[model samples]
Target: MVTSPEEMQNEANKKFCVVVGNTVTGICTTSNAPADAKCTATDPGKVTVTSVPSDHLTILGTLSTTNIIMANWSKAMWQSVVNRAIRMLAWGPLGSHFFSAFATVN
Candidate 1:
């Protein structure tokens, strides 16, 4: 039984490669987790699953679904960084110049 979110995601990572049945999908990589559970990926795509924490109890015979949202965690993170940089530029004296530079790269 997994006690924390980290352990839960680790288990999910092991199963990520199996999301597409017996075929190998993407290369599995550890990434950010969900608010309530862990998330991992395989190949170029990610497969997310939710698990009940060891400290939490659930009734038997309940159905649980694993919804795979197609979003690149790494890309999101970099986008966040880029947003912050833009904000900094907008707030500073050199805001216009740097903001234009960053925008042009997009």
Candidate 2:
């Protein structure tokens, strides 16, 4: 995990791998990733994937939302938002399932 600004910069400099059919097709960086490739990173880690080749919609959705949340909210604030959401869903029939599926950052 990246623990400092310098580490984050270094991680950003690293090339992202682009694979197809169990074989690597190319390598790219944040600035040059293909239009179809979605790349996202937080202080802790990064994720990159080709949108068309991958069928993991849940992963894509989580990555997108997590990136947005981390970009806009501090840890404490984010936790508060999550807690509020949990509370709001507490009375629902799907409360347990929602809580289990909800993502939280450490």
Q: Which candidate's lDDT is highest?
A: 2
Off by over 4 Å in 2: 1-70, 92-103
Clashes of each: 4, 0
lDDT minimum window of 10 residues, candidate 1: 56-65
Error of 2 at 36 (Å): 47
For all predicted structures, in order, the TM-scores are 0.23, 0.27
**Which runs in model 1 stand beyond 4 Å of their true positions?**
1-73, 96-106
**For every candidate structure, what is the RMSD over all alpha carbons to the true structure, in angstroms?**
20.6, 16.5
Residue pairs clashing in model 1 are: 26-42, 26-43, 27-43, 89-95
Tens digit per residue, CA lDDT, model 2, 12-93: 5565667666645555455433333345543233343334333432332332354764688777886887677667666566
Using TM-score as the measure, which candidate wins?
A: 2
